[model samples]
Target: MYDVVIIGAGPHALSLLSRMLINTPDKYEERPDNKSLFFKNKSGVYKTKVKDNPQTRNTPRQLSTYLRKGGVIDENVLNNICVIDRHGGWMTQWSKQFDALGISHLRSTSSIHPDAFDLHTLVQFAEDHRREGELLEIDGGIRGSKFTGPFIVPSLGLFWDFCKSVVKRHKLEDFVTKGFVTRLLPKDGGYDVCLASGDVIVAKQVVVATGNIGVKRIPGWARDVYDGCVDGSLLHTWDIINNSDATGIHTSDVCKQMVKLNMRNPINNTGNTVVIVGGGLSSAHLVVKAAMSGADQIHLVCRSSIKVRQFDLELEWIGRSRFIKLADFYSMKSFEKRSHVVRSSRGGGSITPYVHQQLVKLQESGRLIIHEDTEVWECNKDENHWSIQLSNGHMVDCYIIWLATGSIVDVTMNPLFCDVIKELPINIIDDLPVLTDDLEWGCGSGLYVMGALGGLVLGPDALNLAGARGGASRIAHRLKC
Candidate 1:
């Protein structure tokens, strides 16, 4: 029995948990009578102790079923707020995923980290690594690149080291458990968390940060038209490459597969054709990686004109510096206006400044081709190759098709909280849950959401580190931690 239970032990969860710990009470002990609530719920449902606060009692019971939101959890809640994750340890599989994808650094800037007090934790991390020279001032330039002269991108190695340091400094490993959360059912004053390991956890508060585990979106167009034509040629970024049962999970199977293909047939061979669909930051990175990996020919198909920018939403939303602007947008009373603002701020097929330059260079050298303002309408698996027809009537074929189409946020895909969701009288819009002003999914239930699932209130920044910070701060304040 715990006060709060965080689901998913990734970067977002780490950030939230760090803040909660920072605000944790030196002595976290519930009253004698209140403490027994822990053992009382062993059968499945726990009768939670409620506060006498009117605002809390009237609050709804809605919660972001899948999220990793943060800030100073109640001190009494700290001891009980153990983290639950499918993968063992913190950020192990996530780091492996990035390594497999060949990503050099995160799209976010340095100020974003798990430390509740240290906004410059990552920046300080780079400095401590004797890589101060490699540290890029995130301003007036690309999100993660230097502002001037030689554009320096933080190597993934540096980022991994920093993550390890955070986990170590916070002693996060002690509070984590390995198991996939199969379902969450609300009863009495709290929720019951069921895991694949045949264990049940009763939590008064919950934060879910499952990174859309195994949930990939490959565009309904291709799936509905061609059935078996999309077999071996298609792959999603989140899919485990080779399905390794190794210690940590890897989300870079597509990148590794393409690299393997490039290894078998070097660029000089000119035999293999690799087509990459979607043009977001992931696709942008994939294009550079695929071209450099010796793929004979690479085609980048984007539905919209490739918009080059630092971050996905806007230059202001980077790091918490300009986050106030986003908060202002969230305050709007008009849902239509809010939806429009979110849609207009979206940078769907956008690439970083450096990747934009790489695309230009690739095109000039005739190594990579860009089908801008086009989409893959149909695909047919041919004899050891894939035949693809673009929305613009263009046709091409490739040995493999890596779809960087991104993840699906449709809450229906994830049924872990179906029982809980049904019991809550919460409103849903656009397949997203409606949240309160403080980003809490419900008012009094102590249920908060972060990541893509909290987009309704966090706006476009919900899934990023900045949003995690904001969510943490709000929840911590609510808990008076």
Candidate 2:
């Protein structure tokens, strides 16, 4: 039996793995006068190495080497850990989503990444690779917060390369098993992780790091119409990325619809119109893609006006104010109240200011239309096109209907945890489970959760890149303790 089994191999899993290694005591002894090579400036920011000691500059390189094959960590500790993913690869789903949606860069800052050893690891990697230009500054830096300086975001390509480097550096490939965990059966102070292929792995502890799977939220109309049918003309953004076949878009091939839409003739010379439903960043990306693909007109239908912001939430949650807010959040006894705060803080689907500006430019060019305060009242699909009626009394007949609607993170819907929950029932608020301060299930259960499902404790940024670091740190500390 393994000491620990991580359920998903996404960024969160990588973060947890890195953090666990950080917490694990090194096998090699260090100098007696060992001290931190890096130090913070008067402004309390941890920059590069101290200039006084030129030897200290190698500290970052030492830390980087720490994860290599012949690193300081004990081999037994690494051998005891097991990680599994459905795709059997690191960052498979995460990279797929980025490529499918054509996202240019990350929404979170550069410092917020999977590396748990140092916050500036990603920045340092960018500098090391001489791809500093890929680290674009966040439109507006955290102005009033102590987290000042250039709020940089890494390009998707750069981030992908960095993650690959992390996997290589950590030598994590040997620890990962390729399988889909179907069930988690807790017994005898441990759990049996059942995979889809009739294989089972027993572990003393389990970490459910699966990103938003089995939580696709569909609109009432779309559900009634499609009824789980894999229609080529209509597919959710998550569905397209996760299951490329659902929309006739093969993963290995460029989106077939783009070419088809560009070549298809317009109905009654009105041009090839496409309707995208939602106002989130994904929806905006789709709008821009369709517009660039020569779609005559694109309609963005939102139930409310588009909420534009630099990040998912205000800068406060990500800046130094998060500690105070988290303290207040933890103090509240009611899980329901905490849930309300999370929902309010997230608000709903929102687009970034940069993407919003792109949409506006497309609108001005008459290639895009924004329909705010409207919903898809009705939808009728034919062999040729889709006829949709908006709540605001506008009728749209388009060649394709893309749903950029966000997903729902319901822990109850997760099949792997169904048996575990039944065995040890825990308090759940609005589909989010109440975990211990260490993010573990109560009663000394070794099962732990990370990602959006852990929002009740991690706060609003629970699903973002930053949350990975926070969640991983908690779980790793608990395991080490």
Candidate 3:
């Protein structure tokens, strides 16, 4: 039995693991009465005698010490913890999404990353690698704040490299078990994590770090039309990006080159037409990527006018006044109000200025068309061509249709929590479980949740990198206690 079994190996999971490892108690002793074994419980202190030692603080010296130790890790933590993911690798899905969408840079700054040892670890890595050029500074005007920049926005390649270094430094690669968890059964104050491969791992504590484990939001008109279309012709951004072999495009700098090439030599007309639905960042990326790939008539269909912003939420949420904003969010006694704040803060899917600029350039060259205040009323597939009916009473013939509509995360409908809800009986508000301040499911249940599910507590940025850092730190601190 493992002390802790974490489901999912995304950036959020990585953050939690890194923090837990770095903060493990320096010394521990088996209880005298229970010397034969250390029984696991929600308290996490059934038979262990831990000294009142300050956790290894997040400092440069501590990080250096951890690195110098090389292959050595705290057995008190590593031996008892296990991480599981479908791909069995850190940030695999994240990289795939970026590659599929042809994203070259990240919207968030360097301050927000997976490493919990030191907040500035990524910036340090850039300096060490002499890859400072890869770190692009967000314009002061775009930042909407007085805060200046030192090229804090690290390129995709640089960020991935830094994450790889963190994984290697902590020797986390070998700790990951490749498996798809289908169900989590609570038994004897613990959980029997059942995987699709017919294997079960028992653990005292479970952390659900799966990002966006929600139902795909398919427009009502396209629901039935999707099944009738060719396998690859109709797909959601999630499906295309998550599937390994979905997109043939190579990852990384290829996307940057394509954008530049398409802008320089615009293709005014061609036989291919690709229609993209939605106006989020993914939609913007796909629009440019499709045009770059030589799709002459690329149409972007959005129900509302395009919203351009540097980040998903406003800059105030991540700026110097972030704490003040967070305090206001937490002051709310009602989850409904908190949820409203999250929705209002997000203000629906918006694209970054950089990607929006690319779309503008494509539109100017007459290769791309933005259909705002429009919706796909109906779609019919005929001989591999999609006749898309718009709300404006216009018909469009396209070879492929891409749905960039985001997902809807309803915890009540999530199958993983069906049994958990029955066993623990926690209050559910707007499909989000009312978790403890520590993000625990119920009173001493040992099961925890992160990501969007923790929105009530973590606020609007619960699904972003900033949320990863905050959520991971809170959970790690709870585990230590």
Candidate 4:
């Protein structure tokens, strides 16, 4: 069995692997029968640590010696740690996703390194790979399985060579790269991990570092709406990502096709109105994307006027610069008392300056309309189009409607843990895992959760990239037990 098995090849898994290797136990020649040298777990075992026996410590000591000789680490503790990207190619998927969207820049400034693994000490290890050759490099992507054995270190091939060169230049050889992890299950002693290809690995201690890739929470309302609109012309963001012919069309072309599909049929010039519902960043992006795609008239609808308040100084400045109207209905006195509650309950902010500038230009040209303090009461479809009723007593006649609503954590979407989570003895908070402070799910011992799935446990920041790093670090520290 392997010492650790991390699920999902995303950044979270990579970070955890790096931490595990860095904190791995080292053998010493001074002590022969020391079992309690490292930290103990709840069961009073000394966890996983190397012994200090002269004969047994030779290999580990030699490895450490080699590392020290190469200037990889000054001490043995640093040598034990290994950190590498779970994916053979670093940031390949993320970079592609961004490139497809024509997003040369990020909506938020993220603190991530080129490798995407975010541990300070582990990064240092990868920077010094030339001096220490102990770190093994694996290349095969993980396939799915339930079997577990000693951690299988796959061959790195050319990828390993590139990583080795990077480590040598950066002095980070202590970080080893093992390809993606596909599936994980608890075993008799520790855990069994299955790879994407069908390889089985057994480890004494396993860490499931699968990030949010496999988990998708389609909100209840969204699911209902998606089902209802399937026959009509409605498309979700997920659908767009999954169904689009990426190579065949540009981003604008995809958006235009989506808009056309949403319209259901050829729309008359006077009938081609679009309504986008939501108050979040995605909604704002949709507005601009739709406008760019040649929507004649666009209407943005939100439940409360708080949408305006969610804007930051930068966004507010953009709003002023663009002259976009702000709408809120609550009495000023009542708003003063409920502002804190509103901020806490209502999630997400509005448009960014970059988007706001574009939106303002559109509005100036009389292309966009904003409707605030309105809730969608009901939507009735006719043979020709849809008629939407708002709580504000206004009626919207449109050829297409786009629900840019947010997501919810639904375990049903994840086939791997669907049955397992259902059988576990734990409380599901807000339909999400009720994790402990360490981010471990209440039902499983070794299995931990991060990313959007842990939203109930981590609050608003749960799905963010930085949040994944924080959750991974917390889970790693707990595993040291």
Candidate 5:
């Protein structure tokens, strides 16, 4: 039994653990008369002091000490929180998949680091017992509950070392990690977590930090056309990423197919030749990367023309500059004219002129082409290739396809908590859990969610590095209460 059982050992879960331990009270101190000390800000957005209680007021100090001692949250918090079909180690999997497909560089700059949460702190805690590249796999789940004391703290590796230090310093070791939880229920009380190996855990409080595990795939219409094709003709980007075994295809193969299709079906190609769908930084990067990769013929297909506000100005300026030479720019307005719409949750944004100038150079060399204001009606498979039909009655024969589609929050697919999520009344935002303002789930007290799953209300930043930090702070405050 555990006091708090967190599903998924991703970044979000680790951050939450750090916050929770920081809030637990020390044992040597006398019981403070103030309950307000337990309640901090709703979210960890603001810092507050325990007006009448000095013990609780030292929460920040506790956190600082933990950090200095090299404490980190658990790793199991992000189970299966990865791109659907990529391979490699963790974050590097997607990059490797792109490389396997002959993609030289990513569209966006790499910003994630192995020790993103402060390596110095992590190193300090590891007295050389464990270093990078060490794999620690724990096989078990919470089974019941027990009350160790008022202080409930869980530990893992260096994080545990720091917790032990804090406990010894505060004389609070009676609160062991093995049996600190009080009660465990199926839904509201806690989550009934069952691992793939048949181990089970009943936790009093559950925090689901699983990112995009239960969400559905790209819309059915999109999947139908992409997956239905034979000869590797029409396919989603995910299929390409996931199907690492598929061979004899290169990124150039995809580009060449698009060009041939346009030349064969000039009417469709001329009006809406290439439709690149998506509106994220990934999309913008793809536009530039494609142009740089010698793809002269292409079109951007999207749902809306409204660019991400923050990136719009930069992209627009890039378009007006040399980058426009790479490919023709089109938006939802252009596609609407063709009576077709590509479904994507992300909105279109602008690109840099530097990238566009490269496109222009490619076009001058007869290597780049552009089609704006085009809509795809349907995609089907012919003998060995794909036959793509546009709304304008023009058909394109291509050997490859790329679906730069986006992702969603999905909990149903996670093996650890699939049953737990199904039994809860948790609200769903685009198929993600709806969290309270304090980051706790409304369905169960002490249960919370973070990361991309919180995107509906938290905005687009929910999956980025900044979002992780914000989530950590928020969860920390909740534990304080």
Candidate 6:
């Protein structure tokens, strides 16, 4: 049995472990001048505001009960903690995912990191390593200066290396096991984390950071329509690039295979036109990647006009605009209001303006073609290529159809969560669980949640690094370490 079973090896899980291992000062509080952006929890905990509802299993005051007598783990809890992941190599899955997505840098600022003690731990690490020149200063207004500032975006290399450093410092890899958690059975004092490999782990407290976006979002049309086409070059952005088929094949051999296939079938050749469906940053990045990878025609089919901003959310949303508006939003009786606020703040997947600018350049140079406010009306695999029908009734034939649509957030998709909902009273809002201020799944339950599923308490940034830090702070504060 373990003291705490931190699930997933993502930034949130790493953040929680960092906080638990090291006693860090909650230094550099949110700026209060922008009342809209700053939200102080008052003292060390939130006040008990219980709503007298007979049907609800947990009253608001229940959170205060957990806070009053929160969790406790010795500094050596790292040894007692059991971390589970299918990949087994801490955050190698994330590294693979980011690389597969063709992303170069993080969308979040440098201030956000897994280090518990210092917000600028990453920046310090960069400078200490004498690689300060690699970090780029953000040009947008209200930039954060030097340490503990979002004014800088860490290169993917810096961010990845920092995470590895945290793992090495804590020796967390030794405690992590490789397996998929298929079921979470809550017992009297803890939970039985069952894996796909049939091993079960018992823990005093279980933190669910498995993330909501496990699978890629594939439209029904694509899968249903292309059921029997071996020549079809359809793929998701998350698909393993170096699949088992391409494992032993050298790059030259793989090219020869494609050449042979192209000679046998002209329609399967993706050396020219490639249609990328979706309007998110993933789609934008992939569009550019396709062009660079030698696809001369990069056709972007967007269902709606692209929403391009410098970051995920606008600057105003980061500050008073979000806090002030969300305060009024959270006070409402229903969870729908808070849900709407979270969704509307960063509604659709958006590309940064820098990407938008690049796409424009690509378009002007005739390397990229864009179809805004359009989607696949209907089409099937033809003899030559996949014939496409746009929502605007345009006809086109393409060699590749790439779907960069983001993942789905359905709770039912996760068997572990589905089992939890069956046994416990899980309040669902817009398909996400209504977590408490402590980020716990329910009242008095040892199971705490982080990542996108913690949207109820994390406001709008539940899925990003900011949300990861916020969730970790709450969990850390409620600890008796």
RMSD of 4: 15.4
What's each prediction's TM-score?
A: 0.79, 0.87, 0.85, 0.58, 0.52, 0.83
lDDT of 3 by residue, 63-177 (tens): 5554445334576777788889988888888898888788999988886788766666676677666888988876565644523333257799999998888788777877789
lDDT of 6 by residue, 1-481 (tens): 8877877878888888877766534533222222323444645222222121112222334423322332343446566677887778677667766675567778777767776655656676777677677577765644322122235778899889878877766656566778888889977877899988888888888898886545678777787764554553666666533232445331112233334347334444445677889999988987877776556677899989988766676554453243444455445556788787778877787887667888999999998889999988876766556778888877767766778887877666777786688887788888888877788878778788888887766777887887777788777656432
Global local distance difference test of model 1? 0.63
Q: How close is candidate 5 to the true structure, as a TM-score?
A: 0.52
lDDT of 3: 0.75
- What lDDT tens digits, residue by residue, belong to model 4 across residues 1-481? 3444445444455444344334344222011122333334454332324222112223444444433443333334333333223555433344434433344234422222212222122223333444223223221221113111111221123223433433443344444455544555655655556556676666544444444453333444445655767543455444443444545453333245545455435454435577777766666666776676667778887765524322232222111121110111111123233233233433455554455566678778887877777777777666656677877887877666776665544544555465446545566544555566566756247667766665444334445543454465556555633
TM-score of candidate 6 to 2 decimals: 0.83
lDDT of 2 by residue, 196-301 (tens): 9999999999999998884677889898665644545677777667666656464223235645445355554445678889978988988877776567788999
Ranking by lDDT: 3, 2, 6, 1, 4, 5
Candidate with more favorable, higher TM-score: 1 or 5: 1
Residues 1-481 of candidate 5 have per-residue lDDT tens digits of 4565555444454444444444344221111112332222344222222222112223444434654554443334322111111111122233434443443322221121112233133333443344322222211221112211111111223333433443343222332222112222466555555544445666666665555442334644467665455444444445544454445444434454445454334332332233455544444445555554444455445444423322222222111221121111111123222111111222344433333444456557654433334456676655444566665555655444455665544544445435545655575534555566556766346766677665543334455433454465565555422
Ranking by TM-score: 2, 3, 6, 1, 4, 5
Looking at model 4, residue 94 earns an lDDT score of 46
The top-ranked prediction according to TM-score is 2
Which ranges of candidate 1 are over 4 A from the true structure? 24-78, 137-154, 224-231, 240-270, 319-324, 479-481
Cα distance off (Å), candidate 5, residue 355: 5.8
Best-performing candidate as measured by lDDT: 3
Candidate 1: TM-score? Answer: 0.79
State the number of backbone clashes in model 3: 0
Clashing pairs in 1: 67-208, 67-209, 70-472, 71-472, 241-253, 279-349
Q: For residue 451, what is the lDDT in candidate 6?
A: 84
By lDDT, is 1 or 4 better?
1
